[model samples]
Target: MHIIQFEGSSIIPISILTTIASSLVGWIQVKRYSELSASYILTAHEIGVIKEQASYVSSESDFSSFIRDAETAFSREHTQWIARRVANRKPK
Candidate 1:
């Protein structure tokens, strides 16, 4: 659609677009979306492993261990999320 077309001065439009793209990328990094996604993926894998262990839970102790491990995975993820939020809030 070329809504930002500039007649006879193409550099201005290109420069403006570059600046906007850079700013958007910078904002995404500052928000740490990638790190948050990694954390989620790791947590999901840990939970999946625990679920697999559930099938073999034949004793009370085994069930207790599974629960503890599952809770630990959840706590670790929550702790990381809280830490990231706190870090972002700190003055830079």
Candidate 2:
């Protein structure tokens, strides 16, 4: 009876330790995911703004304004594409 009681008590500490470790790992993963998701959302928003600006520029007939807006939009789109690629890369 004494030996069985001792063994059971030992397992309690191990179980508690494992649970704590797992919880910490889970929290880290959640934090990382949230950060990544937020970054993606921001990039999407920037792209949307650039697209809207380009549309507005196109509606106008000034060649210089049109060229500037188009160039800005193109640069923004390229940056968004790069961000997407980086975000999707597999963790080493």
Best by TM-score: 1
Model 1 clashing-pair count: 0
Task: Give TM-scores for every candidate, taking all chains together and pairing residue i with residue i.
Answer: 0.66, 0.51
Stretches of candidate 2 off by over 4 Å are 1-12, 59-92
Clashing pairs in 2: none
> For model 1, what is the alpha-carbon lDDT of residue 59?
97
Residue pairs in steric clash, candidate 1? none
Clashes of each: 0, 0
lDDT of predicted model 2: 0.69
How accurate locally, in lDDT, is each candidate?
Answer: 0.84, 0.69
lDDT of 2 by residue, 1-92 (tens): 22223643642455666778999999988997787687668767866776676655544466577677667767876786688679879999
